[model samples]
Structures are given as structure tokens and as C-alpha cells.
Target: MKNLLFTVFTVAALFSACTNDADVKTFVNANGYTIYNDSLISFQKMIIEDGKVRQVGGEELSEMGEVIDVQGKTILPGLIDAHAHVMGLGFQELNINVAGIETLEATLDSIKAYAEANPELEWIQGRGWNQTLWPENEFPTAADLDKVVPDRPVWLTRVDGHAGWGNTKAMEMANISQDTPDPQGGKVIRDRTGKATGVFIDAAESYVTQHIPAPTAEERRLALEKALEKMASEGITSVHDAGIPAQTWELYKKFADEGNMITRIYAMIGGTGNDFDELSKNGPIKSYANDRLALRSVKISADGALGSRGAAMKEPYSDDPGNRGLLFYEQDELNEMVDKSVSNGYQTNIHAIGDRANDVVLNAFEQAIDEFGDQGLRHRIEHAQIVSLEDIPRFKELDLIASMQATHATSDMNMAEDRVGSERIKGGYAWQKFLDQGTVIANGSDFPVEHVNPFFGLYSSVTRQDHEGNPPNGWYPEERLSREETLRSFTLDAAFAAHQEDVLGSLEPGKWADFIIIDRDFFEVPAIEIWQTKVLETWVAGDKVYGNSD
Candidate 1:
């Protein structure tokens, strides 16, 4: 009886040891305080089991097997860039970046130097030039580029990515002339002499653009991969690719299925006739590859950009009298597209910059909602840069998302005031006002238009300051958002915009283990220093996708 009792005791001890080991497999130390990673509602004590969050704080804590200390590092949800053009990055790097070039002479000089060095290339392509940044702020004549590249055709796009400035050679090659009437929804900037001045806005630029060589498929793939890597490194786990081609969407699907896709993509099909037709026929594709990719929206360009003076404003520009900007799409056509998209189960994301443009889009969306009866469609207004106070309420009433890029507010602050004057400034980039009314904002850096660094967007949203924090106080201080609001715009709200709130945008149990470790806690730091914060590590699904230490 004693020997039997001893054997039973030994077996019980062995079983208890196995149970402890099993518990160890599920432990994670959150270091006491509850983690409000993405949204405050998602606050929990995490149990990291097998590299993924297994359970939240509860009775589960005592049973949690082992604990791995996260120390005191504040872990937030992995960020999402709500609006960006990712494929454009590689092209921007390979071609000339002319967005911020201040002087026509300097722009020509840069092109001339580039042409001289890359004589083997077939054509010269560059983007990122803003005439507003120039001393004269006047459109440059084709004569300037002609003098530099008379032997070769040159095309450089303005900073807003809405217009193009071409040389005389390009105009001749495309058969553009004084007799060529402005295409519908476009303008060919001409001299008082009735000659083409090299600046083409909206649809007019496409005459030259359509002729330029499209990048090869391999080129597109490589550029996308490079852009994804950069996004992951910055702790951006997802992005709403603002205007993507159908072909690019195919590539995204291929990559996602193969597990090569590193970031969650909410792709808004570029509103080309082909893209609209294809997406409409098939209907919305929700959460491909376990909620990694989504395609349910169409992006429509309502008007051009403010920098190019093509943003259809309520009043004429403060600087350029008699010009209130131009609309890219006809009103009737826009309404039709919205109606068709809503009927076909597709959301519409319209880019509207100037006050007038914002009004136009808001009206269209209102009409759609009236007819369609708000089926929880999170329709979006991209940019919404300059708005009227009256139109602001419409965003909430219609349940439309304010898909804004915060960097645009700070970046354009210098010239925006000069363009719109004080009366209009109140409604421009009014983030705080929108939030007060219970509107969700999805923030991003319109990359290639601005830098893709999410920190810059966060900094600008919180402080309304430029990188250097000049001018003593921030720009439009009343419009600035708090740190929490800014973070939510990049994470939780952004996820909600993309219809991905369930699986991502929060570091909660059973959700994908996606989070970023920043060098400093944004909440604790001085507002200005937020711009200087660096991403320490980026994780996706419990795997380290990018890390400085790794």
C-alpha cells in the first residue's frame, strides 16, 4: 500500500509539471497598466501565446502560463496610411522630382543636367514642381524647357500631381497648339499671345501623358515591393491606396495570396472607365487573404489641386483674380458614377480640394445617399482641403468619411492663407471641428506629393507645425487635433475607413498581432518633438516584418 501510494504521488507531480509548461506557452507580460493600443475601448492586458495575443486581462491572467516582459514601452496599433499613391514612389525616384522646385531657371537647370547624364534614356519624365513656390508664382513658358531640352521631349508634372508642364518639343509631338481648344474639364495654360505656355491642367495634360511610355510590368511590381518595404519599416501595416489601376490590383492580389504582401491594402480603383466597369460587374471584394486586402471603392477626382490653382473654389483665387479653379469631372457624370457605384455595392471616394469642389462632391454624395438610403456605405471625401462651414455638417449627416492628409494642412499653410484669405481659412483642414461633430478622419501623407513618413502626418495633425516649428505658434492652431485624435486617425479610424476594424487597427487578443514600437512615447513627448520620433520595430501577425535592431 505504501509503494502504491508513492507511485501515485510521483505521477501526480509529473502531471502538475506538464500543466505548468502548458501555461508557460501562453504568457505575456504587459507590465501592469492596461494597454490602449489603438482605440481606448480595446484596452486590455495581453497574453502573448505562440507569438500572438491570446487573451485579454480577466480570470485568464492567473492561468496564463508564462510572462514575457514588454517593459514600459507603449505599444500602439500598427498604423495605416489612409490615402497614398504607393507605386508612384519608384517613378518619383527614377524620374525628376520637381514638386518643390521654386524657380523656373532652377527647374530647367536640373532637367538639363539630368538629360545630359542620362542620354541613353528614351524620354525625360519627372513630377513635383509647384509654380506657387516660385517667386513670381506665374506659370512658366515652354520656352524655358525648350531652351534646356530642345533636342529631346520633356514632361514635368506640377506638385499637386494634377497638372503637367511640358516643353515646346512635347507640345509639338502631341500636336497641341493655340488652336487646340481646352478639353472638357481641363485647361491648356496659354500666353496672352494665344500660344501654349507649357502648363496643362486636368484632362488637358493627358494629351501629353497618354503618349508617354508606361512602365513595364516588372517595373511596377518592383516599385510596389520597394514601397511596401518602406511602409512596413515605418510601422505602417496598412494603407488605402487612393487611386490604383486595375492591373496593379491584380498584382496586389497575386502578392497577397502568395504571402508576399506585407501591408494591408484597401485599394480604391482609379475611376477609369475600364476600372469602373470591371469592379461594378464583379461587386465589392471584401477582405482578401484573411483581411489583408480589400477592394470595394472607386476613387473619383472631382477637381484638381490647390497648388496648381485648379481646385474649383467658391470664390476666385485671392492671388489669381477671375480664376476659381477647374473641376475634373462634369457634375452630371459624377452623379451618375456615384449612383452606379452605390447600386453596385461599391463605395465612392472623391478627391475634392477647393471649397467649390468640396461643395460639388458633398452635393453629389448627398444625392446618392438620398437615393440609396445609407446602407452603411462608408463613402469618403478625399482631401476635402478647403471647405465651407455649411458643407462641413453634410459630412456627418451623410455619414461620409473625411479622408484627409494632415501634412497637406501644414505644408500648404504658407501659401494657403495667401490663396484663400482669412475668411476661408476657418474651414480649411478643420480637423478639430470635424471631430467635435463626431466625424471620423483617416489621415495619411499623400506620398510623392509629400513624404510618406507617418510621423510627419501625426506631428502636423497634433501641432499644426512644420518640421522646424517656425512661426512661434502652429498654423491654424484652432484646427489642430490632440495626440490621441491624431493617433486614432492613423490607426483605429483608418482601419474603420478600410472596413478592417475587426482584425486590425488594435493590439487586442484574437486580433492580428500587428503593432509598432516607437523610440519615444508620443503622449509624453513635447508636441514639436513628435516629428523627430523614429520607428523602432514593426510587427505583423506576430512576425517581425521590420526592425532597426534586427
Candidate 2:
């Protein structure tokens, strides 16, 4: 009887041990199961539990629970746009959109139609008209616009955002004429007989633009929403919005508070006297509101763009003799703003295109660094195009980010060489040189100036060609970046420039689940095929924000 009791007790103990083991195994598997299987070049499978990744590898995933099969798709971290005029793009869409209008007739017709539809509006506002793409590359005269909207004043911008084309009524309203001296860093295109031609470049645009009415608060909110939706659909999860106004910053906060902000925005308040004084009194915002909106930078325009021949060059343009480009701000004023931004713990992003403008910006940044020491402040030079060879190394020496638009090189390739000449072309868009010197480049599209899609950027960076693949061997092929380097510029390097690398820009574990699934694997496909790739879906923080059925 005692032996029988011993056998029963032993059996009971074994059963208890088995039950405890099963309970422990269930808890671990339920809580600890997070995996990312990247076995295919075009797809990746992520397994998550309680919002964090447990593992990421390229192998079987039979053990993973609730498997997300992202098969036959290329997975990459959600793209970051290092430089963009988001508010400007949004506002332009709400007003008149003449982006693709080819001829002068088409531009006038669009304006006439807009005027008829919005009769209640005080001033007619529009943007996006490029004379460069037209049959006649010369600037349009007021007569072209005057024929359509003789009664209504109209203000239209060139595609480069550096020039404006206004009607006769608008020009008259601004009191602009042949005798009106051109603004320091701008131009008023004139006829052969010295009459104003209605085309104004750079600072000259402000002459007519300042007269246009500002959008209402509600209208501004709607524009911001529209911009965010478009950005998410194109695989952009974050943007460094350049030149945001104080009122716009308030609207951004409201949207963020209501959880309506789809894309993370690092806003650079426009550096005006009032803005600087306000910022100085209150101090920089310094990565606030859960890192969704950071107001820690200021944007200053030191020069204009190359398309309008307004970028400040060291020497006169080879094609346009007796004319050097414009500088938007004086050197002394630029230096003061740089010092103020650095002292107040704000990053300074200055727009510099031509060699002379780039030199001035570099000098200011160097001085600021010397005064403040390196606070890990990643100050930036926006559109570092046409940089001098001597100034290229300054980017690395001062730990500055080159926030460049890859498509700029491809788009400008046809005319850039003529503007700077063959001797100076070597220093133009020198991406490879900056990379070799251990500097990080943040890639962007400068949208409304170029396409918002990142593939255009990727294609241009790797091939140095437009969508159709021009120049056979690629334009300035030496400046072309490797496939991996180009991808990094848009991804990891871009994130680092925004000071948000820890959360986004990579698919590693412990990072936010922000990524995109594309139709083609960039690594395995031909360079030309990259531009043709399509984004299938985009996710932000494990939530699918954009997806296409077809």
C-alpha cells in the first residue's frame, strides 16, 4: 500500500511541473514574439507584439505569431524630406496652379478662369510658370498677362520660386517701372528699349507678392492637411518645413494636439526681425511636444536660385555677361543672424546656391561654431549647388549638413554648365566629394520646384539624369553616388540631419515602425527602373497611413 502511494505522489509532482512549464512558455511566446523576416529582396515580414520588434532576420518565420506577409514588395524606412516649402506648396494649390501650363496663352487662360471663379477675392494669386520650358525662353511681358486679366491684378510665380510674372495692373500697383531701381538682390527684366517686362526675379517678387492677401486661419489649416496627405502618400513620413511663419506654427501645434498631423515636421521659423526678437525673448523651443513638432531652427535666404540667373556667383555668368547674380542679404546681416541663432541654441539653415553665396554662409557658420563650440548643432546649407572646391571641405570641418535636392542636379544639368562654364562645373553638385570627406548629405526634392516623389531623387543621385535617362553615360557621372549611398542619403543620413535618427530612418529593432513597401527592389533592378517603382503602402508608428489597391 505504501509503494502504491509513492507512485501516485511521483505522478502528481510530474504533472504539476509539466503545467508550470506550459504556463511559462505561453507567457514568453505571447509577450516576447516580435520578428522581422527579410528573406526576399522585394519583401519583408515583421512580427510585433506590444509594439516593439523582438527579432529581425532573413530566414524562416514559422514560429512568429500574427505574421504580416509583406511579400513581393521592397521594404524601406519611411523617407524624410530634409528641405521643403510645405506651406508654400499648400497655399499655391489652394490659389491658382499653373505648374504645367506650357505657353503664354495657357498661362493667361488659367488666370482668366481663376479670376472669373473667385470674383469675391481681392487679389488674384498664383504660382508655377517657367519660361525656360517654353519654346521662347525669354521672360514674358505684362502684355501677355494684360490681355487676359486687364481688370484684375494677377501675380504668378516662376517654377523656380525665384522669379515672378505679374500683369500690367499688378506691376502698376507696385509702382514698378524702368526708373524704379532694382532691389539689391533681385532684377526687373526690361525690354530692349528699357521698359519693365513684368518679370521680376528673387527679391523683386516681393514687390508684387507683398500686396497679395494672406489666407484665413481656416484656409491655412485646410492647406496644411492637404499637404500632409500628399506627403504621406509619397512615402514621406517627416519633413523639415522651411520658412514657417509664427501664425503657421500655432496652427501646426493645433493640428498636432488634435492628432491630425500625419507627417512629423521640424519647422524653421522665417528669420524676420519680429520673429528673431520673439524667439530671443522666449528662447528656442528645443524639441518639444513629444518630438512631433520641433521649432529649433531658423531659415535665412542668402541668395536666389540658378534658373532665374539670380544665384550669387563669385564671377559673372559665362552666358550672361555684365551680370553677376544677387545676394539676398548683406554679409554683415547674415553673420549677425547666424550668431544669434547659435547663441540661442537654434540651428541655422541658410539658402546658398552660387559660389560666392556659399562662401559667405560658410564663413558665418565657421564663426558661429568658433563662438559657441560644437553643441552637436547640425547647421545646414540648403541647396549647396555651385559650391567652390575650396569651400567643400568646410561642410565637414564645421559639421554642417548639406541639405541638397538630388533632382536639382539632373534638372539643371542641361543649362548649369553654360551658366558656370566648364572650368567651374567641377565644383557643381559635388556630392561624391562631400561624402568622401565624411560629411552627411540630406536628400530632398524641394517640391513644387521638383517632383515630391523620392524615386526621382534616387534616380537622379545614382544616374545624374532625368526620368528619361539622358546623356547616355550620365551627366557629371563622377558626382553620381552609389546605390547604397543614395539610399542612405534619403534615409539614415536624412534622419540624422533632422536629429531624429534614433526613432526613424532605419528598420532596426526598438525604432518606430515607420516604413514603406514598394513594388520593385531597388538593389536588384536597373538604375532606370528605379524611377518607375511604385510605393504599395506606407506606415507610421505601426499604423498604415497610405495604401493603394491597384
Best by lDDT: 1
Q: Could you tell me every candidate's TM-score relative to the true structure?
A: 0.89, 0.89
Residue 344 of model 2 has an lDDT of 83
Model 1, residue 152: what's the lDDT?
A: 79
In angstroms, how far off is 119's CA in candidate 1? 2.5
Backbone clashes in model 2? 1
Index of the highest-TM-score prediction? 1
Residue-level lDDT of model 2, residues 1-550, one tens digit each, is: 1111111000011111222221121111110111123111221244333333333443333323444555445667778888988887777768898876768678778888999899987778878887766678678888988888888788888877899888889988989877977888888888898888898888778888887777788888888988888888888888888887778888889988988877888888788468766655677775655566888889999998888899999999998997779987778888898988888888889999999999999999988888889898799999999998988998988889999999889888878998999988888999998999998899998887877788889999999987777888899898899776787788778878877877667655566666777787676678899988887787776667899837
Candidate 1 ranges with C-alpha deviation above 4 Å:
1-52, 56-74, 99-106
Candidate 1 lDDT by residue in tens digits, 418-467 = 88889898899999888899989989988878887899999999888877
Give the Cα-based TM-score of candidate 1 against the true structure. Answer: 0.89
What Cα-based lDDT does every candidate model obtain?
0.79, 0.77
